[model samples]
Target: MMSQAAVRQPINVMIVEDDNVTRKYLAAAIQSEPALQLVASFDSVQPALAWLVSTPVDLLLTDLGLPDGSGVDVIRACVGRWPDCGILVITMSSDEDSVLACIEAGAAGYVLKDAGHLDIVRALMDLHSGGSPISPLIARKVLGRMRDAMPASSAPASNADARSLLTRREAAILNLIARGDSYGEVARTLSVSVGTVQTHVKNIYGKLSVHSRGEAVFEAQRRGLLRMATLKAREPG
Candidate 1:
């Protein structure tokens, strides 16, 4: 096994936002951190996807609404390509559907656009440190949803089986993929290759006995491996 010292490395981040102003601001924030390297910034999903195919990164900070497509697509591509990469959805949308959909697709963190730069920085650090972070408001919404989903008669079982079946990293990647992150985004966030991400995904699928993303997500939900609200609460801000 690799030593802890050997495993430690600087994080590479990518920002995908349609607004030039926002993109620049995010890039600047990422650059402010000594431990984080700003790899690239893009205005649309297509170029970001293309860049991801050729380059490697550690994290993806994206807006849900993009010029060409939804930020969710960017997440999907990243998770498909980079399974170890961390995915954080930074968007203006606070609608429950948008939040739930992103979580179901595999986002590790979700923050509203209103969140300050410090919050975003803290969130990125939290995610890098293996913590799932969500905005406070988002967390409340997620908690409410979880409460609503729970059966009144019985408490939900902790997904010890599923948790034991996969490493924390694998679970994180799977969760993001379930939320909507792309292979490329996953690769970048995890600082691994796309092929590596695919390998992990394949392993996850085999272990879960699921074929498609939908099936994997359903299984994850059934196994109690993913609690939509719990993940949100784990976020930094």
Candidate 2:
């Protein structure tokens, strides 16, 4: 059993969900936990990112779809800024592509929106303990992708053209976006402010010479960077 002292430090959390009702529900659920604190909440990626620059939190929970951008962007930004922080993608998307994208963007967990409060609580606890909590269906898809990629006799090497255009981090973020997370989620996963994520994205755009999310994703794919399933399979345990 955990000691009293261990339980005293509340786990700070930020919530980013576009839906007002769902966001309120999530906030209430998180607030109910004695060990968790809802530090901030936002309905869009831009404002959330703006807040993160000044306020730091231990966990970030977000949805894939937002008014401004994808939640993958948030995850990348978070991971970039606060690599130690935990990120959870709490969304309705169960598509393999979206699930794989969240993981690639550095989310520590993926809980389906339909999951009950208990399931979300379990995911939070798991994340706190350094576990990667993914829904069963997501896990199976990731495993299948891994198995499929393992037999490649000789995978194509990253081309110099692509390598020269994007920095390692930018490339990674692009890959995550292609998979479908929001910018606020990316920021939390990366541990950086939303502005920083935006900067990297802007840099990615400038370097790749592309504008807009779809264009960036397509370009990254053409350059062999949108391999979400492959990347997730290779992530360290």
Against the true structure, whose TM-score is highest?
Answer: 1
* Per-residue lDDT of candidate 1, residues 1-237 (tens digit): 899767777799999998888788888888888788898889998999999887877899989988898988888888888878888888888887887787667677777787554456767886765445565566555555665676754444555555788878788887776554556667798999867877787788888996444446556765667657544644554
TM-score of each: 0.63, 0.60
lDDT computed for candidate 2? 0.70
Give candidate 2 regions above 4 Å deviation.
1-3, 115-118, 152-237
Candidate 2 TM-score, true structure as reference:
0.60
RMSD of 1: 9.2
In order, candidate lDDTs are 0.74, 0.70
Q: Whose lDDT is greatest here?
A: 1
Report the C-alpha lDDT of model 2 over 1-237, residue by residue, as the tens digit.
Answer: 999977688889899999999888888888888888999999999988887777777989999999899999988888887777889888888787887687778776776776444356656765665444555445445444554554343234555556677777787776555444456556687787767777788788777786445445545655555555734653435
